[model samples]
Target: MAAANYFESKCFLFFLLASLVVDGIVAAAAVPKQQRLDRISSLPGQPPVAFSQFSGYVTVDETHGRALFYWLIEATSVAEKKPLVLWLNGGPGCSSVAYGASEEIGPFRINKTGSSLYLNKYSWNTEANILFLESPSGVGFSYTNTSSDLKDSGDNRTAQDALIFLIRWMSRFPAYKHREFYIAGESYAGHYVPQLAKKIHYYNKAHSNPIINLRGFMVGNAVTDNYYDSIGTVTYWWSHSMISDKTYKSIMKDCNFTEEKSSARCDDAVSYAINHEFGDIDQYSIYTPSCLALTNGSRQHMRVKNALLHRRVSGYDPCTENYAERYYNRPDVQKAMHANTTGIPYKWTACSDVLIKNWKDSENSMLPIYKELIAAGQRIWVFSGDTDSVVPVTATRFSLGHLNLHIKTPWYPWYSGNQVGGWTEVYEGLTFATVRGAGHEVPLYQPRRAFIIFRSFLKGEKLPKSKRISLQLSFN
Candidate 1:
């Protein structure tokens, strides 16, 4: 009897081991090794770090050979448990890798000489998995087989291609399937972020079980309504003393904010604002020093062109983009990043002038979309850097005031590290905050404070309202 019992036990153990092996095999097969193939072992001049990073192209349109480039910086600790954040930089043509990753919120800061990278201690990845995508076909390392695609890119196509990229990317990195997700961007991405969110929202509704679990979105110093943005911008210039009162009045009187193109008188007035009123200062961050090294002619267009930049290649960078251009163009950097594999004709540029000049379509207003999403209970947040004259806090406030939502928490000073970081107000369906003394690129100027607000956003908590409480999180 004892021998028979022992034989049965041995058989059970054998079956258990076999089942485990089969399960492992099935799991491995289900998740592709493409993600592993795209992993970065180390970047040139990169310091040792504990986090994992992956970068490569996701082909969106096979016939056109159109692909979007993405860089995933996993969270510093317990990354799988943290939510994923998709970040975009707008110029309709800027590279997120240049602005978002290298300067604003990414893990590394390029040294002055572009020879090496140092860790960004206050990187957003500490709170969430940050995915930086260079969207449309012609931006950054992203490319297209057809030349026409670059010149013909528009708002609609940009949104559609981004959705496609995410669908395929999630499949390639199957671990991220159905993970809590959020979209965030600055400047023109006011349009991209919301439009993409709208697509994701409706797509999920159409399908029984969607792969992306999108929770909310955030935009900073965004371009919302052309009319409101224009009006508010001119007002900001005069109010902030960036332009003379005479120039301001001429712009206000002559420019029809509602029109697609400003009248000749308006253009001339605006030109005068650029040529005569403003000096050799960085218009984006009025209080900051301009990058004297990158200065050519006086920059024109305060709104949305190459002159108009969510493009962080200028202003208070201290010649940061010059360094970034050098670093990214290096052969070693490209190889390590798995970027510029095809060796496209042009060098890697921060913003593609071709796409910017010939952009096919744009939405005049995003207020309606904001209403729709807010009604659907989407968590929406808008923040501004008070020092950014380009898309100043005043411009955002004017645009958002049109929403007419009930104020949940009245405006109050929010504290970070025993100092007033900024002011914030919570609304029925949205939240608005400002960063004190920060510029167009908030993190580049005020990283620790940026982290605090970001952490609060992820947790669905309000910014700390008191210095005593702020002191607790100051060490972060």
Candidate 2:
């Protein structure tokens, strides 16, 4: 009789376990497809495409009603097998939608007219599932009900909010929850990528079933160390004949680039170098012409200067920012993307002027975070566009010097096709490379080369070296 009772108990436990498993499956299946918000349909003016595109908001702060806008473009082919890449643009306030997606490496480029779109032959989406996010509360279509969320934005808060967004985003798109993921960005995203990666690493350690499969991160012409970046900028300007020797000397002698507040003498020197010396040229891409020519009339000078400073680099159009601004603000475009759902008070912009002015916190150095992440066995790649003076390759090189990492691969030229593309070096924990003539926006200046390097990054392979034509070997 006791044996019979034990068998019955085993059967009951087995049935309960099966029932729970069945319930879990049912619950997962019950998630409504409509709730997935897989885009109300395709966007108009978009070039014919095979991959799916989805755009919507993911609420990060319920109390403040803060939500982030995202545009996810699936890979052109075999998207289910490709890794997912989250691309952020750092102004601490820039719209990834406007810059990263529409103007740089996204699947489509806004036409010069701003009302049409063109296929980007070298879109990063061809290599991976690309996700562009407009972060914080005030940038692009992302917003918050509580006005303070805009003014209170900082590096830490932004990173935390982005982390929350990623978690919730994964919940909505469960297919990508366990997929390999990478975070990449440029300029100030040097802060955003590392901080968010650190948060994910911490969360993975604390949780039993980690959803985010964060594999690595990359930053381009990033502002990693402010002091190094400042010094490098001044030195680069001087070396490149963009500033007077006297100005350079004065800046070096009086400026403590590491300080939060610059000395008056330093400020004066920098102003002379940038304003008087560089003049009306685009500071971001010193080699590129300004979107609008500097007018001789003093009345138009300030406006021209602002336009130069704010313009995005596009090989095809210098006025890409103007085009993007018009494209995003259109009611039809917003409706198609399912953006501005609550009728936010302000129009969408490429960069948030208010957030930039009110930015509360910025770290001088992200090297320590890089060190921690590297030691934790995360892949790290730092690439620079050789021609970008704003955050020059010199700045990146100098900053990496602070890590004192052991050299794994000595610096060598990498090739794209039969021509030299850039120089690359591998350290014990990090890799550094330069896109030969590319500017602040690498993909904008050299999309094909950028795609090649990007593919190498994802594959954990060294960039290709020049091959003999007789061999008929191609890197791609």
Best by lDDT: 1
**Which candidate number has the best TM-score?**
1
| Candidate 1 lDDT by residue in tens digits, 1-476 | 99999999999999999999999999878767888779999999999999999999999999999999999999999999999999998877878998899998999989988899999888999889999999878988899989999889989999999999999999999889899999999988889999999999999999999999999999988988887888888888899888987888888898887777767898788778876778776767778877766635422232442134322234345578777788999999999889888888899877777887788899988999999999998999999989887778888999999999999999999998878999999999999999998888788778888888888889898999998887776564
List candidate 1 stretches off by more than 4 Å: 1-30, 297-317
Note the Cα lDDT for every prediction shown.
Answer: 0.86, 0.82
Poorly placed runs, candidate 2 (over 4 Å) = 1-35, 293-316, 467-476
What is the per-residue lDDT of model 2 for residues 1-476, given as tens digits with 9 covering 90 to 100?
99999999999999999999999889868764633565546676877788988888888989989999998999999999999999999876888998899878998888767778889888999889999999887999999999988887988989999999999888878888889999999988888999999999999999999999999999998988877777777778889899888888998998886677777787677777766888766666777776662233311111110112333343446678777887888899889899999999988878887787678888778999999999999999999998877788898898899999999999988887667889999999899999988888888888877887788889898777664521232333
Q: After TM-score superposition, what is the CA distance of residue 396 in candidate 1 from its true location, in Å? A: 0.4
CA-RMSD of model 1: 3.2
